[model samples]
Target: MTSFQFTKMHGLGNNYIYVNQMKEQLPEEELSEIAIRVSSVYTGIGSDGMILICPHCCTCEDAHFQQ
Candidate 1:
């Protein structure tokens, strides 16, 4: 079985499963399926949804940075 680490967090009674993509990655094509599976209360980690914390992509030219 394939497994990745995750953290569960909540605020104001809302909760979600957070996956740090900076440390690991899931296949882009399977993200929707993964979210559904992980969000199931009876079969999975049980959350309102899944959140992927990814590294910042600096490749976007339109992005502006302020000091």
Candidate 2:
């Protein structure tokens, strides 16, 4: 098994699952599947969603994009 830094934060009795990958190696293509599994209310560990704190922010990190 591999170890990584994770911080599970909760508010208003609602909990969130965090998977910090700043210093870890994970396949990006498998995130959605993992999220769905983790957040599933049945047949899996229940949670609101997963929070990913990474080092890079695609192209929006330049702070010059319009939504």
Candidate 3:
């Protein structure tokens, strides 16, 4: 199992788990599971959802620059 790092934050009351995919490499298939795992209120990061913060890229094919 591959593990990544994340941070929890709120904006004007709404909370979300932030994942910086720019620095941490993760498999594409695992993104959905990561979001679910991180947003769990019982045994996880405990957030409303996940907000993946990735780098900006000109290529739409880039994982971080999903269209």
- Each candidate structure's TM-score, on Cα atoms with residue i matched to residue i, is 0.77, 0.64, 0.69
Q: Candidate 2: give the clashing pairs.
A: none
lDDT of 1 by residue, 16-40 (tens): 8988999679987888888888888
lDDT (Cα, 0-100) at 32 in candidate 3:
76
Q: What do the candidate models score in CA lDDT, each in turn?
A: 0.80, 0.67, 0.73
lDDT per residue as tens, model 2, 1-67: 2334556678998877778777885577776677777668784468887777667868664432211
Candidate ranking under TM-score, highest first, comes to 1, 3, 2
Regarding TM-score, does 1 or 3 come out ahead? 1
Worst 10 residues of 1 by lDDT: 58-67
The sequence of per-residue lDDT tens digits that candidate 3 reaches over residues 1-67 is: 5677778889887888777879776787987777777678775868878778767767566553331
N/CA/C clash count, model 3 = 0
Model 1, residue pairs in steric clash: none
Q: Of the pair 2 and 3, which is ahead by TM-score? A: 3
Q: Which model scores highest in TM-score? A: 1
**Segments in model 1 whose C-alpha atoms lie over 4 Å from true places:** 59-67
Q: How does model 2 score by TM-score? A: 0.64
| Superposed Cα deviation of residue 53, candidate 3 (Å) | 1.5
